[model samples]
Target: MKEMQGELATRALPDLVRDLHAAEATGTLEIEMQGQRRKLHFVRGEIYLPAATPLARRLAALLAEEHSDGHELTALVQRMVDLTSSWREGSYRFLESKDDSGGELVGPLPTLEFARLGGASTSPEAAEAPTESRPSAPPGPPATDPLAKLGGERARWITVPKRSGSFDPAEQWVLEQLRQPRTLRDLLEDSPVPRAELLETAAKLAAAGYLRSLDRPRVETGAFEFQSETLQRLRLRIASFLEEKPLDGDLESQRSRVMELLATREDLDHYQLLGIGPFASTDEVQRAYEEMARLVHPLRAEELGLAESAGALTELFDSMTTAYLTLSDNERRRDYDRQHGLGPEAATVTETSPTAARQEEREELARSYFERAMAYEARAEIHFAIEMLTLATATDPTHAEYFLNLGRLQARNPNWLRRAATSYLRGISLSPREIPPRLELARILEKLGELPRARVQYHTILRIDSTHQVALARRQELEERIAAENRGEGGLLGRFFRKG
Candidate 1:
């Protein structure tokens, strides 16, 4: 195709970019707008500004200085989104002849979708705040508006030939007032344009290429908000709670019992799960169930206002109830023993069980991974963040908090909900006393349409903390939903039941 050239005023830069991307065009896009000349060298419609070139290197350096994010292409595209969104009268030429016309990838990035998510960022680990909500420092004058520094040296922000696009006499008069670089504060004080109208005009004129932001955007200090390992780890431990304090002895022991049941010897048969010999009598089983209840009930957690603890405790108690029910009957207990290869002589599991030893033998090299995972999350590098957290969980699978943190990050994206479910399951398995992961796991399960499993999760949570509003409400919702589904299936009993 012949080289294409057009005035930016006729077609916006983003639209032009979309067209180039749609056509999968291979070329160098040359743009002269907003009183500045720019070039975007693309290979098959993707940005390929190799740092081997001077322009690319300069742009890279500027992006590195201005944007805290490490992904160079993402930052560059974000800058393009910001600048191009306002372009009014600029000329763009697309030349399909380039050295890298072979379609070799520079980086698998800066796609149209990638550019859209650039404006906002959320840290997957520590601290949560929208970047747009934060105030930007005006280069010259103090303004209450987010788009501060209207005039003054900031006036040069529009660059020379501020009147780049065609404008009426009134518009020309406004440009004349801005000929001298000055603060927006002074312009509002001295100019005839109303406050609202001036801002509106400035925005409109800026988009039409009448004004240009000559300088790179100033990122506020500490915008990324990376926290220390100690603080972030503590935050992970606390889950949704704002404060962190040592657990009470009784609550801690109860949590320990739940963890031991959920994780340490999870391979046990029902008899072993209930901590009894295969031939234990009904009374013995009853005694064991009662003892386990006292150890695993959420009442202590509820009393201490530990919602997280209560959630996990509730889950443990549910399992104990199942085990109790199964072992309490002679036939079910015998059937369970046969399935698990246990006999009447099978001994109770001891501290030296192979499962516990295997857990203890896992590597503890997750500190570095944890640190990088947070940094990657803050940069919106979800893939890298997931990779790092996966490594962390694998290397130190015993750390309940690590799994919890990983699940939290995975839960941020809808596509990752399955992975998030796995992570939460692992977290609760490792630290069966933590209520947050259980609640999250149930929520994710509900979203995934695992209603029965979610209902069980909520039921367990209620077992620990009877007053849990969300669990109570969601469980009722799930009950109704499941019942409705049963009715649709033509079941005589619309009040449905499901196995965990």
Candidate 2:
């Protein structure tokens, strides 16, 4: 079968379809021509049928309506061969719904009426139009693969070119579903747009060649019986609707919402605004902001290792920063508080931007750097600790704990006292209620011989925390020194006057 040529070779359909089914390929199997879409069905290595998707009909209507380019079926078949060379995985990522770009491709396939060579027996006539006015497919069996039941049905198919723009949204959505399979009907029900429009759009997209159905998935029924057989068949058909369609209203609306939500803030701290037990300080906030910005920033999309996902990452960062800034601000924090009926300190809602929701990702990376720096500090490797702390701060400055930790390390190192003081101050600015910063600052002042200032700082600490034993002791010692100095001065003045 692999050894054939011309039309036979150009059409790898029968063999490719069989292999795909054999492997239980889970994603879309798109076949494109110069610009048309073709639908294929497979089940456990069996090539059951070939059909035209609803999207193809929509595309044909569009071509007729716009007087745009029409398609030749043979050329489309050839183009499909050309495309096959690029499929290392032999499948494309699945989409939950048609997108504007994908939908646009479903313009239409040229309907061909064949004329017999001898002018005998059969007469040429236009193909019969469907009885159903709406562009729709029959409800197939409830198998996991939606197209499994429609085998042996010969139907027209079309293909279209890939749309120029970002596929980030489509890619993300597909990946989200890879973790959990969904049906076309489920997709429609979840969409924000009208179901008919969404379906029509998906059909058009399928015709354009951006979407395709999946093969019937193999179900691992118990030891004796295969269960979900029907479900597996239905899933393939459902997969088709998704592959052929652009994103529906729900997906589009959600994407827009994420973008809008992203646009409103600059820092990622709904958690901090809620005051959920104080994991970080101002320094931590700055560190976290920069780190997140690096990951989400449109500019660093390539540099920070999101080259393929540059667009999505950029948009994600934009939303994250916006969210962060909104939550970071006191006034905005209050507004959010009132709206959500939450206190100044509360746990953050899990639902936010998709990008921001990846906290586990951030935390995992964050914890690694934090723990490494702490380990270095524990070993008294001050320089290494400083470097690690610097990286940690850069990655997640919003964590006040990092700043305090860094400052403490600096304070211990003889050569880093000045830097230590700076870090401590930053920590203080972020969290004024913390005692470490206040104590560290007073100690630094005392070390620098700023006795007056040190005493004042100690007094301030006493005011805030009256039971502070260290501050009380320091204040008492400073007072005694002042009294002793006054007595010595008085004695010296009296002796000088007597000698004179």
Best by lDDT: 1
Model 2 TM-score relative to the real fold: 0.28
In candidate 1, which residue ranges exceed 4 Å CA deviation? 1-364, 489-500
RMSD to the true structure for each prediction, in A, is: 26.2, 27.6
Give TM per candidate.
0.31, 0.28
Backbone N/Cα/C clashes per model: 9, 78
The residue-by-residue lDDT of candidate 1 on 340-440, one tens digit each, is: 42433111123244432232223323555677678878898876667667656644555777788888988999998877876776677667665677898
- Over the stretch 1-500, how does candidate 2's per-residue lDDT look in tens digits? 12211221222333333334334442234555334444433332222222244334443544455554334443332333222222222222121222222322342122111111111112112112221321222232344332222211122111111223244444334323322224554443243343334444445444332333332222211112223454344334433543564233433323322332243222323442222222344455555554444333454334434367556654454444444554456666456443432322222223342442244544544465678777766796766666566445544555677778888887776677666655665566567677767788778767765565567667767768999999999989988776666666336775676577
